[model samples]
Target: MSIKSATPYFLLNGRTEQAIALYQRALGAKTESLQRFGDVDGSCPTAMRNRVMHAMLRVGNAVLMMSDGPEDVKLPEGGNVSVALDFETPAALRQSVEALAATGKVLERVFEAPWGALFGVVQDEFGIQWMVTSPLK
Candidate 1:
């Protein structure tokens, strides 16, 4: 069997909406579809009914899937996973870095890397790490 596509799925606790807004602003992400827990046939808990059950976003050529995970689960502050974004132009990369940094912590400022590329790292408010980079000109 051949794999069709691989997408990054984020379990945002109860902040999926906030993350969605941030991605829209920082990465020009568009929500292709979203389903709320309330959409289910009255099986969801009252508190979680308003939360997002699933959302599909299109960022550039990639698709990002996310959800407000079950209430019992708690995500740690930082994890081993990081989302790496590669841009075609330095300007685009810089723009995304600034936007993400506005509401997030900049672990590394954008700079020329030894590998001949511009790179930086930021941890968003939701604790999701991002590595932003662009190829050398």
Candidate 2:
């Protein structure tokens, strides 16, 4: 078997549901699978019975995984990863940027760059960072 380089995972402290919903709206992500801790067959700790054990979403060409962090898990002050989106057309790209920005802090609004693309960065309400880009014709 071959191994892929790496996959992105969000360790939501207590808002897996909200974060999932936000991503659905912002990126058109579809939930492919979800496994709740409670759904696990007997054996797992009772404290984790209601937590989100695992979830997978398909957004564009990427797959994102998430889990509700343990109640006692210490959350880091900042997230280290950013999800980047590359759009095919300016209209779609602009629309996505606008929509995503509505519920996030736009670190960089979409704008033309010397590299011949429109690009921006946003930190969504849940603190997940995103980078959006659309190449110029």
Candidate 3:
């Protein structure tokens, strides 16, 4: 068996662009690729022509894949899966948390744990949950 790379993929109904912009601003993520439904030939509804058909974002070395499609059934609170971002500095960690928390909720504000690490959880505006962490210097 051969596995070259693994990435987290998100399916957000009518919100992929918003989520992509949030990550790009908060995590220093770069847009690797984007293909809108409009790019497809008659595959999507004209109402959803501007919707995201596919997108790839690079945060550090991690690649995030996503698309805006049909709305999903509401979970208890979105879902159980969480995307975590580990950082090497306090500034980086803080910046990310603040960015993701914009128009969102901070489940756990950044704080020092007994293990001498900073940790927190935030659900982005799109209801996607995330864990942010950093080691104390």
- How does each model score on TM-score? 0.92, 0.86, 0.86
Candidate 1's residue-wise lDDT over 103-128, tens digit each? 88899988999999999999888888
Better of 1 and 2 by lDDT: 1
Q: Model 1 TM-score?
A: 0.92
lDDT of 3 by residue, 1-137 (tens): 99997787888877788888888898888999999878885766678778788999999978899888654443243467898888999889998888888879999988997778999999988778888889987
C-alpha RMSD values across all candidates: 1.4, 2.3, 2.4
Question: Which candidate has the top score in TM-score?
Answer: 1
Candidate 1 segments whose C-alpha is farther than 4 A from its true place = none
Ten contiguous residues with the weakest lDDT in model 1: 71-80
- Top lDDT model: 1
Q: Write the per-residue lDDT of candidate 2 for residues 1-137, one digit (tens) a residue.
A: 88985678988876788878888876788999988887974667888887888999998878999998777887762388887888887787777677777877788877898899988888877788888888875
User: Distance from true position, residue 78, model 2, in Å?
Assistant: 4.4
> What is residue 124's positional error in candidate 2, in angstroms?
0.3
Let me know the TM-score candidate 3 reaches against the reference structure: 0.86
Candidate 2's displacement at residue 32, Å, is 0.4
User: Candidate 2 — which residues are off by over 4 angstroms?
Assistant: 1-5, 41-47
